[model samples]
Target: MRYLRSRVVTFCISYALWLTLSFSVDWQHLLIGLLVSLFAAFLMGDMFAEQAHKWFSPRRYLWFMIYVFVFTWECFKANLDVARRVLNPHLPINPGIVKVKTILKTESGLTFLANFITLTPGTLSVDVNREEGVLYIHWIDVKTQDVEEASRIIVSKFERILKEVLE
Candidate 1:
């Protein structure tokens, strides 16, 4: 029962993604997408998270859309900051790998957070320690060495939204 449900869920998501990416409604494209999605779902459905029902939540999708805007804004600001530092010789960058704590328990949530951090300019996600619930991030400007302070500065912006969307 659980296996069948996972496959169905995976197929739905895979087919949706294919449609979005292909951006074609033609019967030929739809047929190819269906075949590909079915093949993907069949091979990887069992690997889907146990709490796969979360994918069906409308609230999660809303939060995810909000998160996209927040992420884009953060990236834009980071780009400007990095550009300023690059252009100005007086601005000192305190570069260091700082450890920040994360409250996210799920693997997908953690991965999303890490990827977001890495994607943002002037900061890079060096590593994630799941057991310790910590992420090692290399920041262009280290504001504080304190764990809580760093987490608040670096992780809080994305973490809260990610918890709603993925956790």
Candidate 2:
């Protein structure tokens, strides 16, 4: 029963992705998308968590939507900051790598956090230490060397929401 549920969940997600990416309502495209989504679901269905039904929960979807907005706003702010630094040569960019701890226990949560940081302008995710629950990040401006402070500055906002959405 669990395996069947996983496959159904996978199929729905895959088909939605297909339709979104293809942006077509034509019969041929629909048929092809269905076939491809079925193939993908069949191959990767078992990889999903046993509690795959959580993915269909409206609460999780709402949290994911909120996360997207937060991420986009952060990216926009980072772009402005980076642009400001670029325009003003003496804006003081102390480029260096810093380590910060993450409370996200799941691999997917950590990966999403890393990706969100990397996608933002002034920061890059260099590496992830899952065992230690730490992430190495390259920051354009080093505000403080303290791990707790750095984690708060770079990770807290995303981490809180991600804990709800992904973890």
Candidate 3:
């Protein structure tokens, strides 16, 4: 019963978002969108239900938004720094892979951090070891071999934000 209620709520919320963002609420379009959303919700019922609880959490949503904004600002700054280095004749890129241990316990949290790393310029999450909770990231530049420092920066700048939203 709880599952079914969650599914229905998820379907309605998704449909409403689609309606507000995509199409007008004419009878035909509304019916079609509702059917499609319902089908999708049914197909991914478990995922929807799991995330639906988080969606209703105002604190998580607020923290997620704050994280996104901060991430965008950081990305922009990194882009400029990378561009400057690239355009310079000296080419100061010290590309290498660094292994950083991740503190996030959940798969979703780790995946989010990996995706965030890849999305930002100058670094890419190449591999993740679930057993050891380690992430191998390729960085365009490395000033030092201190993996702990790298992990600290990542956790302080990004993972903390993710934890606020996800944990």
Among all candidates shown, the one with the greatest lDDT:
1
What lDDT does candidate 1 reach at residue 162? Answer: 97
In the range 1-167, model 2's lDDT, one tens digit per residue, is 44888888889988999899989899999999999988887888888654576777888889999999988998898888888998996887889999999999887898899999997768899999999999999999889889999999999988989999876
Tens digits of per-residue lDDT, candidate 1, 85-148, equal 9899787788999999999989899999999998786789999999999999999888899999
List ranges where model 1 is wrong by over 4 Å: 21-26
- Candidate 3 lDDT over residue span 1-167, tens digit each: 45675687778878888899776868888888889998887876776556556667799989988988988987898789888998999998899988888778777788888988987868889999988989999988875568799887654578788988886
Write down the TM-score for model 3: 0.85
- Candidate 3 or 2, higher TM-score: 2
Q: TM-score for each prediction?
A: 0.87, 0.88, 0.85
* Cα RMSDs, all models: 2.0, 2.1, 2.3
Where's the lowest-lDDT run of ten residues in candidate 3?
A: 47-56
Clashes of 2: 0
Model 3, runs deviating above 4 Å = 9-13, 48-51
Query: lDDT scores for all predictions?
Result: 0.89, 0.88, 0.81
Which of the predicted structures, 2 or 3, would earn the higher lDDT when compared with the native? Answer: 2
Q: If the candidates were sorted by their TM-score against the true structure, best first, what order would they fall in?
A: 2, 1, 3
Worst 10 residues of 1 by lDDT: 48-57
